[model samples]
Target: MLLERGVTDAELQAEANRIAVKVESIFSSYLAGSGDGRDRLFEAMRHAGLGGGKRLRPLLTVATGRLFGIAEDRVIRAGAAIEAIHVYSLIHDDLPCMDDDDLRRGKPTVHRAFDESTAVLAGDCFHDLAFEIIADTATHEDPFVRAELVLEMARASGPNGMAGGQMLDLVAEGQVLDMGSITRLQQLKTGALIEFAVEAACIMGRLPPEARTPYRGFARDIGLAFQIADDLLDHAGDEAVAGKRLRKDAHAGKATFVSLLGEDRARQQCSILIGQAIEHLEHHGEEADLLRAVARYVEERDR
Candidate 1:
């Protein structure tokens, strides 16, 4: 299969690294303070929010915004807000009541580093901060744009999206799930925020809803592909490189794409999805090189 090419792995990593720095800086600024009784909460927030990861969601936001000629600074702020939500989700996901994870990004999980209550509060604060950043005039001057961003973020993170998918995931433990059920579970748990990342750019660009069909297609495809790749990683990827535990799904008797389809078929499916995702960008030109690179990266990343 011939893939569209412009950006190299080094270039993509460089760009991701740059975005990571900027987003972490934003978290630092938002989290900076002292002399309060809530200092531990702030420290926990900083620990989780500032910890480095792929930062893929924010990268998508910025890359999509670039397609619309949006200002980089403005888009970066919006991306930072989305990443804040992502970090918040990770914090909660790692809690004892949730995934019960001990390590994240190769370091102690927030609950382990601090305490369970502090981790919970830090996650809550980050959730609130996500909306605070989005609703602030700094993200966008237009009230309507800010409002739309808030609405989408809420839906993506609320009961209908990530949280709902998580519920489904928990329920599926030790139960048999068909392909459709597993797909839907991942779409909500993983895809919703990814879709929001792209849609946010459309909102900022003021693109009409009707014209966003292709971008939506692109987001949906890559989102599923990303999750499949994650499942593959869990099935066979190196835990040291992944910076966390793997095979927990299998251990818990949860059905995943890799578990259902097996390794070869699952990898093929990811390739097909990445190809379809890039096809959605057919109308775009060189300016979309980063987005194309991202789609391929989603399929090829080790962690």
Candidate 2:
């Protein structure tokens, strides 16, 4: 597969390292450049970005941008922004008030690493940086377009999207939910940002309206697919391999794909979603291959 050939462990790690370094450098005003007020911004931003993960969201943004023949530098900037959004989500999710997670990517959660206040503030600052980068492109003729894309991202990440789903999760906690409600919860909580990611690239690249609709559909499917695969991983994968705590879903009594469908059927659903995700890519062929590979990678990866 085109995506399979492109994705490699070394490729991911190298990409993560470079993006982490670049994000810090690009946003260093908080740390290296300015007023005391900015110092806290840099600290929180760095705490999350440099904290470490696979950098999948950033890579997804970049890979999709490449579909339109966008320049590498622009792609890198956009990629870094995506990473910021993702880590920011993680920072908030790991809070004692949220997921209450102590470990993230095998390290202390942001709140644990610094303090609860710092973690909350860090997530907020990262959110600010994401818009800053996207909006800063106003010098370009397409600045309005880029700004719109960022707006879409903000909607997905904010109370209406990720946060909304999280609220539902909290309310539904420890309760038995029907499959439909469970899927809806996952779509909002886990899938919103991912859907925004693919569409963001499409919008930025200025894909034709005809093509953009398909990309939106593709994004929605892959978003749900990846989330289900994550649920599958929670059960079948180990903490050592999953890169964080394992079986936390069952421990927390959250309804997951595995919880509703059982491991075998959940794996079966993963295959179906992966297949559908790839099928969605067929319209764009190689242009969509990287995303196709990403869907496959998400399905196959233990972590």
| Worst lDDT 10-window in candidate 1 | 1-10
lDDT of 2 at 133: 72
Candidate 2 residues lying further than 4 Å off, grouped into runs, are 1-41, 138-141
lDDT of 1 at 157: 89
How far out, in Å, is residue 40 in model 1?
Answer: 0.6
Q: RMSDs, each prediction?
A: 1.2, 2.7
Counting clashing residue pairs in each candidate, in order, gives 0, 0
TM-score for each prediction? 0.98, 0.88
**lDDT for each residue of candidate 1 in 163-270, tens digit (9 for 90 to 100):** 898899888877999999999999999999999999999889999999999999999999999999999999999999999999999898888999899999999999
User: How does model 1 score by TM-score?
Assistant: 0.98
Error of 2 at 225 (Å): 1.5
The TM-score leader among the candidates is: 1
Clashes of 2: 0
Total colliding residue pairs, candidate 1: 0
Error of 2 at 164 (Å): 1.0
Model 2 lDDT on a 0 to 1 scale: 0.74
Could you give candidate 2's per-residue lDDT for residues 1-303 as a string of tens digits? 333455565565565567566655655543452567766656666666774576667667766776787765666666667667777888898899888988888777878878898898889888887877777753262866777777787888878888888898899988998889988988888788887777777777878668787667767777777888888777778887666777888998878878898888888887887777666666565655556666667777777
